[model samples]
Target: MRTTTHAAQAGGEPLDVLIVGAGLSGIGAAATLRRRCPDKRFGILEARSAIGGTWDLFRYPGIRSDSDMYTLGYAFRPWTDPQAIADGPAIRAYVADTAREYGIEPHIRFGHKVTKASWSSAEALWTVTAALAGGGERVLRTRFLYLCSGYYSYDEAYRPRFEGEAAFRGRIVHPQFWPGDLDYGGKRVVVVGSGATAVTLVPAMTERAAHVTMLQRSPSYVVSRPAQDRFARRMQRWLPQGLAYAVARWRLIAESIFLYRLARGRPALVKRHLVAQAQRQAGPGVDAAVHFSPSYKPWDQRVCLVPDGDLFQVLRTGRAEIVTDHIARFTERGILLASGRELEADLVVLATGLSLKVLGGAAIEVDGSPLDPAQAMSYKGMMLGDVPNCAMTFGYTNASWTLKADLTAGYVCRLLSWMDRRGLAIAVPRRDRAVASRPFLGFTSGYVQRASRLLPKQGARKPWQVYQNYVMDLLTIRFGRIDDGVMHFGAKGCLP
Candidate 1:
């Protein structure tokens, strides 16, 4: 790793690849790059002082992986823990350990928050600018820019204001920026939103709070699975460690794919099964249809996961309640619902969703022209149409994020290798004007819908389409041809 940070080292001499964000995708990208393109110069620019992006950022109670660890864990690393559904700290440690194991820690530059990147076709390089966490700024250049900063803003969360908030006496908290000194013990807690966060918080807060209520405008589909994978444990007993891990990983992947396909193919059948399962899990009193059954089909938005029916168990205990009603206003003691019901609470948790941020909220330009992501089309769900020498690591919406992130990293490495072999300087995905454009993501989720106009569009065909399937992505991105005619390559001093 380069130790110097002078203007020349920072900006003058260009790196082979510059990765933004040291989170899950960024760390995985670095590890992949080190293995695939060992000799290439690279650096990871992390805005925060530490690694473990999302895991490190969120410190809310019972913060854990919604996806199973077997699939969420990196392709190269084996998640050997007995618990398949690991918590936030464990996942963060796993990521940090992966970086240490791959010798990626040395290449990471902490406190460098990337602000903007200007791509010069003439120089075949990107002039990147980042703000220092302490003070001042630093400029750097790279041949290829890989954005793994994630799709949501870390600086701010999607926190919608409620009427009469100032009149409320209790403290209101957003899960994104959870307070370390918060004391909700013996207090009536109300968690807003029926998303993954709310579900996780409801059961967790019930442990300490007098009572916890999950208040949602609408319900979300919830799936309950064991915390530990019995099959994984059995595999560990029968097979060697590596082989066992591989088996468990593949098993989970296949199961998720099958389940997703089933849900999509037969939404009504899956919906009925989910509702019935929730009803059985929650026991007699709870109305599954009224609280657990989502209006949208499964996988339309992400299905919330509750390990070992934790949420349902809490609901069964009567310590937690799921209320489906709009918030009319914040009352002095609690919240007033649209149904003319009032729920008294001492504390409120806004477990609302995240705000979508494209490219870590960094500005991108090509030939001194700013790139509007909304106008540009996505290429293979990673690169933008007409955007040269750049790739963004966006994961699958339907499956574990790492499943798609790993494939994306591998594809970027392949692209780099292909360019190296051919002595090429630039590679850009040329847009096919004939192809019809569609939304980047196919979800009715509020966050996605809100950011619809800000996101890039996907084409109706392969190479330009963003398939949320891991199998298709693994086949095409990992094994498919690099020079598929869509991605135009150029030699030095030549623009694609």
Candidate 2:
């Protein structure tokens, strides 16, 4: 929205807050700041030209939100769409519309990719350096820096090389960078991986391709739900739109919490239910044990969602199939599996996973010393330990991402307000030396495990712990005290 970078307009005056990334989290953070702390001047620096971060970037066929829109949608803005499982373009438009509605567009500086943020205790400011799209550098200073750049790299997708990838004659595509003009119609397609992307692609491509085969080393949990919420629709007819939306949101949130708890508390029962559902939906020919059941328990990795049983429907129709085998290599015709079986394909889609990155790959420095997110313990799942005047929104691993992001934004606003009332310049989390550290994410997914060393560590105690539960975070972040003993606050040049 804003054509020029903030540095050009600041005129040597630092902003009250500088938010990185104009994605879902960043936009939500800006809107929250405008509503709660209107007196503070803030600017959003977006690396890309578009407003929708993930939605705008991903253009693969059948690209849709894995999570239901009721919970994924922002709390302030109620999702009025009839389809609870909305597509990428619709979600992108929703984000852009929110920005316009809140008058948050004008404060956004597009194509200003933040490279580094350095905090100075003496000045109590964060000097941010960004690379402009037009090939120039700009510097901007701010009192507080908020990062919502997301957890993964935008420039790269997790593309693993096959043993003989170069020998393959057909075109290989990564879903992250889907080619617009390429046609898969009447072609045999083999999609690699069993994650959300692969699940989405297999069903979507089956409609156009001659046949689609989902090739994976192991199976992931897949669940099916209706696209529209009948209850939500009925609620909208009776109650006010906002109230109806809130009710639906809460209902979905409660169901999620209950299901997650059930899965964790009674893994055997939950797994049996999931496998039974899959077996029934997948029809007779499909082997549920060989291709549907996952080795690990539910929630160990993200469960893939197939709206309206679209994936199973495709499988039953005989347009698509799932192959549970390891890729021995890429042959001249297709992929050769470890079972000495060869699957022929005209096109290969590698929907492996995402490559995770911390702080949008921006280097962070505190008082001229480099700050490694891996080394720093996560405080309240947002702020890093001993890191002053900064907060990053890392969403819930179990539920919808926006649930935690919204809470994080609200907490940041509360923190700023508290500091203002007390005339404080800096607020940093002080990790207790006694608290033990654990992996930031408990997910056993390939992406999470690969980026374990790149992510921040979570603490064992309260306030320092990253509880993936929404209810717990809601109480702690929204209603909790700001001057908790774990967080130390002070003025500039008088460090706490």
Candidate 1's C-alpha runs over 4 A off are 1-11
Residues 253-283 of candidate 1 have per-residue lDDT tens digits of: 8998899999999999999999999999998
Error in Å for residue 263 of model 1: 1.0
The sequence of per-residue lDDT tens digits that candidate 2 reaches over residues 401-485 is: 9999999999999999999998999999887888999888899999999999899998888877899899999899899888888
Q: How many clashes show up per model? A: 0, 0
Residue clash pairs of candidate 2? none
Clashes of 1: 0
Give the C-alpha lDDT of model 2.
0.92
- Against the true structure, candidate 1 reaches a TM-score of 0.98
In candidate 2, residue 445 scores what lDDT?
A: 96
For candidate 2, what is the TM-score? Answer: 0.98
Local error of candidate 2 at residue 387 (angstroms) = 0.6
